[model samples]
Target: MVPFRSRVRCGASSLNMLKIAGAVVVLAGAAVFSQQVQAQAFPSHPIRMVVAYAPGGATDIVGRMLAQEMSADLGQTVVLENRAGGGTLVGTDSVRRSPADGYTLLFGTNAFVITPLLHDKPTYDPVKDFQPVSLTTVQSLGILVTPKLNLRTVQDLIAYAKANPGKVNFASSGNGSAQHLAGEAFRTAAKIEMVHVPYKGTGPAMTDLLAGRVDVMFSSLVGNTEHVNEGRLNLVATTGAKRNPATPNVPTVAESGLPGYEAGTWQAVLAPAGTPAPVVERLNAAIAKAAKSPRIVETLAAQGMEVRTSSPDALRDMLKKDSGEYQVLLKHTKTTLQ
Candidate 1:
């Protein structure tokens, strides 16, 4: 009889100990969940956003707009660092080799996607080296000339270049840049010949174009608008699929005797591959929100850009398609960087 009672008491004590252990396990899980919550907050430190072009360019403009908005959204400082060189390769490579944390990011353009096509050996792979965050905006290109040139239309420029041949020099930011390719593509499509004068950067190129040292340039509509309006530069054909609302009367390249010819600038956000999917989603959400802001929309519209926000997957798809198209264009046209 004493043994039966003692055994029943021992069973109850064991059950109580099991409950205690389960409670401890629950507390431990709560601690883990709290830590995960902190981690998901993201951007715990200052983020370095790389702009792969010199300041004052279209890429820089978009990057600054996004960095400001992202800083506000993420509750951290977002710094825009310009690493301009090698047709944007220098900055892009820096981001590619950066740690996979969300602290480092790249704000790039169609030039980044098309640079590899012009080089014999690229330093980094576009699809493999980076993850897309969002597509920010698409900008149309305008053909601008110094006021001294007195050029009116694309036809006038073509006639002048055809007559002068190598005498007419056009300025480009750098070799293999979107401006460079746009200039070359226009010359090829229109069957005109113009000497390409590659500058270390667009600032110098624009300076030369404004000083009448260079005959013409294919510049993003953003940077050239004020100059055109100030009568410092002459407006010519725009290189877009259709006429842009900012300059509706300006004929598109395709409509201006070169049918099917289209070239324009675009901007996108990217992060180092292996960044957490949650972080990417957070960044994308912030970007899409900022793009819809009336201030941002009006600011970019004033600069001749259309705000086009897209999901990360959509941006990836656009980059992939553009990469293939650039490769084909390079091969068929025998384009190369010098």
Candidate 2:
């Protein structure tokens, strides 16, 4: 026995609520559909891969190699952009600011983890600002000494370093480079003091090391292989967990004397944070495929690089682990950027 007016108002209210609910449901479904479409139709354009080093450098070479293969797999051009400076901070920041639409990616290295620890206040947060797509390569560093030094083994070098103390000099590509960290790690593990000399790049550092301007250097195995082969520079030991296949005669630092000592460089691809998960997965698959390609495997092997691709989650975990380890190394070495 309700009044006619009340009945009419209640009917209108119920109808309006039902209409609003229906609209919301439609909008939600549309949003999900839009995301699916976006994910399915991704990579409709070219991708820019930012390399955080100068052209002709190891990072640049590796990046270009991967880019060529990934370009084929993704059916899109993957362009290489070299943005060198700030110990890889410049290029990394550029990628960090880029849109999270999968068009821009950072071709990063172990320097990404080391440089931040060197700085008192890093410009970017390594863990929070980017999404790891894949790891490309891992190359060990060779402990190269001038033939004049006549250091034949890791123990010999450590003994000489201990006896010489501050007289021994170690050259690196830059202040906070991976090579620099490796040198520092060596200094710590060997419990010796050596003066650290920074250079513009590996080329310049290798030049000085060869010219006897510096007594020793923790150089890239690939970059200095010719010198090692020609006997121009003495390979004391390799800074890897095991001996390098290219130079099986050389012993690792761990085997030589310092157990549990391992230092090396690695490269990986990362996109800005907030990139779609589907797009990240797609990129990872392409990278994994490229790493497994025969041409790529042969090329990297020739350069003394081992092709090592990993899942995104695995890469993230590695980054976390390495960052912590680098923190300890930097502290022990007393290395500070600013």
Candidate 3:
């Protein structure tokens, strides 16, 4: 029952309200766009690469190498922070719960994927919680026994372990570590019975192995290559499929009468979910360059690691494949969290 002029005026006011709302929305969107653009200029400040190991471990070594090279490539300081505990769960969980701004990253190892399978309540889901940046390397495992063991080769160790059964004990870097998984895989494949003694870190594990507190340990050659060459430890077998050029005389587990046996460790870079795609690609490219550098390649080779420059998509697929296989292995191994 309003007048025609009043109706027209009301309609005009409603149209103005709509226009104001639209303008506000556009302004808010612009603000967000500007913020995102600012974020895309990543590494504006120092970037932290969290390594889940002590300073002297292979993980820390690789992390430092990447950090030094990445800092140069990104034109910012890239620092390594050691978070050694909970079988790498501590540092990995830190990255998982951190902001997704691409500044905080994780230098995750094979244990990162295998930890959840070995534990009852894993803090993060490998596939769901983070995005794979790039695969850094395939780190071969070395099965080293104490000099006092008097075992000449892997076959001898397996036969000895089988003959002795539960009396033989092997040491691992920690519970739910790749070292632990490697030892378990060997036990299952060789059908040998051995008790696993878990240490807080690889340093302690290697210490005990040297003191004969433990019989044997499957460790990365990065920290033990010198000792092996010095004859302080006996090299039984390597977990790689072929002989590593670094240790040309060493035989593979497959070659040591355990056909179809292959287990190894690896490392990759990951960022929290929700990081920008462009930034992820940039980071991937930087890592690819760093990992492929001749200096890094030669250094890693000496440590018995092979460089693998996988794309983000490729790394994503690798995660899926590895996670599926780990699930099967976990079920078969009957590995349960305590």
Give candidate 3 misplaced runs (Cα > 4 Å): 1-32
lDDT for residue 61 in candidate 1, whole number 0-100: 68
Model 3: colliding residue pairs: none
**Winner by TM-score between candidate 3 and candidate 2:** 3
- In model 1, pairs of residues that clash are none
lDDT of 3 by residue, 291-330 (tens): 7788889888887888887887888888888888888887
lDDT of 3 at 213: 91
lDDT of 2 by residue, 44-124 (tens): 999999987766556777788899999999999999998877777888899999999899999988888777777776577
What would the TM-scores of all predictions be?
0.87, 0.86, 0.89
Model 2 spans with C-alpha error above 4 angstroms: 1-31, 199-201
TM-score, predicted candidate 3 vs. hidden true structure: 0.89
The local distance difference test score of model 1 is 0.83
Q: List lDDT for all candidates, in order.
A: 0.83, 0.85, 0.85
- Compared with the true structure, what per-residue lDDT tens digits does model 1 show for residues 142-162? 988877767788888888887
Query: Model 3 Cα displacement at 299 (Å)?
Result: 1.1
Q: Rank the candidates by TM-score, best first.
A: 3, 1, 2
Cα lDDT of candidate 2 equals 0.85
